[model samples]
Target: MPDNGDLRDVESTPLQDTGVRVFAVPPAEGAGPGEIMQGFLEALTSDDPEYDTARKYLTSEAASAWRPERSTTVLANGPSITTDCVPGGREETNSATCVLTGTQVATVDAQQAYRPAGGPYRRKLHLTKNPENGQWRIDGLPDGVVMGKSDFQRNYRSVDKYYYASGTAVGATGQPAAVADPVFVRSKVDPMTQMVRSLLKGPTAWLGTVVRSSFPAGTALQKGVSGLAPDDQNKVTVPLNLKASRVAARTCSEMATQVLFTLRNLAPTLESVELRGAGGDRLCELNEEHAESAAWLGSARSPEYLYFLDGKRRLVRMPMRSTGTGAVAVPGPFGDGGRQLQSAAVSRDERTAAGVGNGGRSLYVSSLASGGSLGDPVLTSAGASPADRLTTPSWDARGDLWVADRDPHRPRLFVLEEGASEPEPVAVPHLSGRIEDARVAGDGVRIALVVAKGGKRSLFLGRIRRGGGDGQETAVDGLRSAAPDLEQVSAVSWAGGSRLLVVGQEQGGVQQMRYVQIDGSALDGPAPGALPGVKAIAASEDERAPLVAYSEDGVVRLPSGTQWQKIDKEGTAPVYPG
Candidate 1:
């Protein structure tokens, strides 16, 4: 047992926030082989300028060859080190090899994008002793570096590198369609540089076909400068290589948008961006207004209101951006019906609604405005009992409604396109379970599904491929685990273009919430604030929209705040327009 007094400190202290944290190096005086190895590992977490200090623990040849910026391997647990000395292997008659092993948590690419790498990590370091000073120094090792998760969090920050979505252009409604590619870069290093470099490199593997960058092929920073750094005036000057020098004036502004948006989260106080060529010639200057004007190129504006069902089973709305407002039922058939909804979703146009009945056996669709009359069930489940009926309904930007009929004997997932009379079945191969819930991404290209298998629930990301006769039919190409580490996934929602806010529990743990990339990598930052007794979860495509959920206390919304605030005394199936 632990002290109750000490537990308070742990409970009250929040997780590490986004900021620079400098890691210090201990004195190496009279350090043995083991001490030298530990010091070398710790030095990897130091800022770029302090990397010279890391070289101190390495031999001259090894120090010059090692490049910490090449890649970063993150471990789930602290590294275990074991050394073996060989008096006869080297001419110095004193050499040792230190083996480091741990379960790899993830790896940050040269572009700085973080991708899940769930497996074992093994590395070896060859060390030699300097007879004169009796100092043990690393003689040989791998090119990159590895560190534990805690240290990685302390040294790196997760930031979304923004890029225009496929086919998205200016004048688009809401936010520009942008897919967020979360990457990890050293907090103490030059994040602006990392972001710019990664943007030039383009989106990650899985998202490659879905998003495109503004930078031209072979575009890169100037040879001498590794990254862009802010000046005294909060102006960041980006020096591009010769490949980018031929860009036209209009294209330069678009290029500036990419850089500005990507660096916004990192340098929030940034005032302007200066584009330059290899020879120090100015290409363009984007002031604060220019950045602000183009910021929504690939993102969405915050939603106006959060919607859910009230105690009377009426659809209601809660103002998300303002305070001092009461929950008002939506005007129309949705609010007029005495119908009780177990789960529901609103279309992107905000004119239509799809809901699952209390027993989940009946699915209904109704117009959200007054003049429209309540209709009969739009779709029904084949389940014989309430527990085996339908899951929550979700709407995508294309006006397609998605839901899963949780019939264990005849489990199926369906999508109802606009103006369609009957829902169409989508094949989900390798689904060794029944579908619990499904949320389609705004682009209508991806779907997040929660499947229950062998008494355990799991979340999977599936790519939807539309092609069948008239191209109306859709099927999941394949299913990949997005929450492989969770014991059970109860709820999930698309938080952004390629990120999902998932509610699940780790092995042997209680329910918790966290943000994960579509590729399955966890987001970097404070664990998403949790809402106690939450039964369902919903989020808008706009990342800034408040997170809505149904809890024992009624309807709760987690705005850009640290705590969950109740909005309604009783509600369920809270959802935002897709």
Candidate 2:
């Protein structure tokens, strides 16, 4: 085995969890084929920036061909190596083949988008002994890099790059709604520079159709420019290529806002970002305050109140910031209990709401303000039972209402534009099961659904594709499991731009609550502590708000850094404004 060594320099920074810096150790002299392979594998997991040490174990030809950034394959454990001499080689008779085998867990593409993967992983590396130095060097190998899941977690961090929703505008805000596109990057590396480059590349293929980038086409960092870091005032200056040099002031400001939002999470101390053109002339400088005004981040807006169904099956709410405050019914028809509601959803603006009542057979829209009468059901289902009728309605950022009708004979998902138009059936191609519940994302481009099939319920996330002016019907495409491990999902709500709070039971396990990413990967942090008998759950886009749930103990809330506390014994379905 090669001896471990410290290769830290003046510029090296400590690893994420460990305070000490870790670097790759070059192969030792006279090392065996197995030892050489082991050293090369270890080097792939190190923070060598350019992977210079890892290349040392490879022959010059192989080194020139290897592209570590092409893709990353994460395994369940470190790959196992088995080496054997070739039966009869041509040019090099003294060559050995090393086979690496493991179970693949996930993969990160060149675009930095992460997707859960499974199945066996196999790769081959051919080695030959240098005649002059008698040193073993890999002559042929696969592209990119492979490492264990633990190393991937320690070396990489997930960050969201900001984009604007493609075809919607926030009312009166005069700004497009901001959407988050999550990607993984090396934490200790020059992450700020990496993130900026990724943002300039535009949204990933999966999200490209629904979101638009502020950067102009072919926009990129100026040639040979790298190593971006915040200055003493926590400000970062980005130099863009010629394509972005001639953008107008407003468009330039929008581009700067995207950089500010993307870097803020990676460097919380970031106060502003200045964009410079290829000519080294300042294009625009956007401070934190101005950035907020440039885009509408739905998740950053705190709700005014927490809404839920009370004992009388009426809509009620309590101040979001006040704990231990008694809930009161709003001054509306649904609040007066004249028309009992089974479930409800409030619009993003909080001026109106949509409720499902009459044993879930009817859907009604009403104003939350005082002195308003409840209108007749805008939509109805002919399902035989309440369970087979309308699910809870959800309002999107565009004020459109979404709900699913689980009637086994006529199952369908409907969207009411502006919550007033006739119900329009949403086409979900390749959907195999009945949608038990549906929740549209605040960006209006994604939807989460709890689908029931073969006596099992699962959570799925899908993209909402609107028709081009040519009269194409709106459809939900690319449906994939969001919580594949959960055998039964009772409820789900968007926790953030790319996360969902889920209540479900794993195969042969008791019911529990956890957070899952839209890409079907488990979140990094600990899941919410176990809560018994969780029937339904709710979470605000703003993470600071408490999580509300309806369980056997009635409606309860899990405040930040605290245990679950009862909100109302009679409240059965709890919800926050979409």
Candidate 3:
């Protein structure tokens, strides 16, 4: 657990299984090779800042060469060790080799990026009798630390570092949308300082092309500075290298805003951040209020209303901030039922909407105001059946509309820039099968896709890359599985900055709803309780809002700490503004 600058003193207590802090016990005198290996592995999971106790079980040369921070290998379970003595070894010069084996689950690289991995894990530890005290000490081992999944969960925590979306025009908020790049860091090892360093290092490889950091190139913490903590006033001060010393005032404020947002996750009480130049001169200062003006955080902005298709196949909505409110028809041709709709999506600004009509063959964009007229279909699909036509439309913060055409004859994903120009086909490189559903994230840089192949549906996350010049194309690259374990995925929605609410079923199991991270990792909390006959799901980036679902019971919602309750039995295809 993190200590948030509380000055109160507490009584010293013995370490137990409380799961808050773990202290490593030094190896016992005259311990055998097996005991030494066990003690050393256990120490790697402890909260020791420098892993000094773990190094005690290694030879001097091994300790000098070991680099625990190089990487972390996560195994499905604790490693199984087998020891064997060297053959034909002299009695006075006995040597042994210990083999450690397990199943690899994931890995965290030196940059603190977590990637799902699968395969067998095997390593050899060479040990020899220490001539000084005749005790077993390991002389050769793997380069980095290894631990079980449970230990990794207990020792580290996931945090999102914010960055500005690259190459995106300013939205209604008059600023570039903020994108979240999540990474795992040691929980009790000065995480506040660790997160600041990560923020300065820029986004991960997959996200780097679509996001830009405010920090100048080569900017880093001043030499020898460590252990950053908030002051009594709930303010933190960050000192930077010379590279950031000559930045403009606006750039300096942007830099401070990034730090303020990143650190708030670990220390919510933090009120402000101050940036200083290499010469200790104040560069800029920013608070939560000011940070909001620097960049738009989609997750922090709540939707004004919840829109869905009513019983009459007309677009309707209810106030998002209110409960028990009756649904009302929206103020447009869609509300008048001039053209019956099958599905709908509201723009982020709540001023316009896009609906798929004519049994999913045509898509129309209209306003949410009264007397608004419906225009010709901006996009059309040639699928022979309704189930094989256009999917539900989705809007991004930039007001761009995204929808997938499931036409078996010409399956493609299309995007309407500002929801007006001719539909442009978006390339999906390396996609294995036809797309069943597509939802663009609020940041407009990441997209969640449901693809079906061989009668199985899986969830994938792809990065949206736009070409540099005109006449060029936009493509979704780096498609990776977001829910690889599920046998079938029915629906997916962005629930937060780096989280998604997923509806799927595991192999040999019933349907279920859960939250998953973009990196394919499970969230720490319990999933939403079971809801029967769920056809579609909707969630807001603002998690405080209820989770809306279109089920057999009609429109239903799941409030915080409560069971699902019926909202509108007549409503279907519920959605919140993107």
Candidate 4:
């Protein structure tokens, strides 16, 4: 909202594109915090980017030192970011300064964990515009608990199309970008009796299921992927590719099934590009070549929730109303009093809901039949106020709610059982810094995963059982698994409790939509052919069909043994007419 000759402005990042003005840089290339402050003060009332001032006053190192890190990636997601912006008119001097309200961590070892990278901490700053740079770059680092640094936002997708954010590496030419909903193509592994018999035929047969034949008669495949034809130049349809064949193999540790998903370009050269994915455990990869698209611009069961990166995809959380009142509306979604459809978690029966967002807290239930008309937001803890925030929530087989407690300094994961009096914290490695994100499995028996200080990320599993003199936190199953493209696991959901969709930070072309599933007990026929364009993964009551929404693609439905298809849209684009 720092408006000035400022040149130009936008949301999230990249306020302006104009180059910096010519000026002398600081004598010290690696100047400290104070020096950076002094130079910024002098550059007040300048054009945006203020390239000239940095050139004249700051050494290349001093100027570039102002970059934001990974931990602070959410800073732009201000505690209270107003959609409205205020224009500049008031005269400024020493009364104002810019503030970075977040934390940072090192990707290396621990010793450096104590070091504060950069931020406003929790203190407010009085900022002034540089008539020259047209920005209010911090004169000095504000005050607060410094966490860590260098998170992976640049590689992350979900960008706003109307106004491109800076730091985005679009194409090799670095030109404008276009997209379609992300598609979630899944290969069923936990095989039914029939599946086991099919696989007996061998590898080629299994591979066929990964890509398979064409769309069925009167199929929505082509229309869903490309949308109404060339008449609408806005059309975006990219091909799908399966580079590796996904298989459920038993690890040296246990008999488990895992599925791996990487960013595979289904399109021909110019039409295709690479993207990033979530960072965490590695799973099996399904390699084939029948692409699908999920658009994010529809409502309810339809393809809505358009993401800048993926085209048409559908992912909708039921209303907070009783499964009886499933007809409720979600305005702007969060922020206001209206109900919000956060991430979804299907119960074994698919009757209960464990989503975290507006209106609802820990877990809520709506009849899958009536879609739970209940309008109350369910909270796991009932002690009035426990001084914690619930986010990225999930559920287990017992209908127990698994949620991560969001606290910069002392974060923990909570378990809310069906009839338990209160939610309890299963001890986790305490991080003096910040606990960014957490997720749980479908069975609800496995341990929770957390991303903490330093790029040194690890998974913690199991209960704090005591055996010897000193009690040690035991290791649970499936924790700290390595991922290919994800910077940090951003989102997690259970697809049949064993299979999962872990959304992470984007980087390079490797991570547009990647997922891994866990299955061990082999039943029968080789899993269903491929299901594509899935952004976020969730399970259905019968396990017959899986609900998926591409981070960029809107929403889609993958039936038991058929190719992917789109569900008709119900809600219109909140921003424009569909």
Q: Candidate 4: lDDT of 313?
A: 14
How well does model 3 score by local distance difference test?
Answer: 0.89
lDDT of 1 by residue, 348-412 (tens): 76778887885789888888888877677878888999879998787765567888888878889
TM-score of each: 0.80, 0.94, 0.95, 0.33
Name the runs in model 3 displaced over 4 angstroms. Answer: 1-19, 84-90, 243-245
User: Which candidate number maximizes lDDT?
Assistant: 3
Give per-residue lDDT, candidate 2, residue 328: 94
Give Cα-based local distance difference scores for all models: 0.75, 0.89, 0.89, 0.31
Candidate 2: deviation at residue 125, Å? Answer: 1.0
lDDT of 2 at 567: 88
RMSD score of candidate 3 (Å):
4.7
Enumerate residue pairs that collide in model 3: none
Residues 379-471, model 3: lDDT tens digits: 988999998999999999888999999998889999999999889999998998999999999889999999999989999999998766787
**Worst lDDT 10-window in candidate 3:** 82-91
Go through the candidates in order and give the C-alpha RMSD of each one to the true structure. Answer: 7.6, 6.3, 4.7, 22.4
Query: In candidate 4, residue 321 scores what lDDT?
Result: 17
Deviation in angstroms for 416 in model 2? 0.9
Cα lDDT tens digits, model 4, 462-527, are 321211236643222323333423555544443332334455554443323334432111122354
Candidate 2 at residue 510, lDDT? 92
Model 2 misplaced stretches (Cα beyond 4 Å): 1-20, 84-93, 243-245
Worst 10 residues of 4 by lDDT: 252-261
Clashes of each: 4, 0, 0, 137
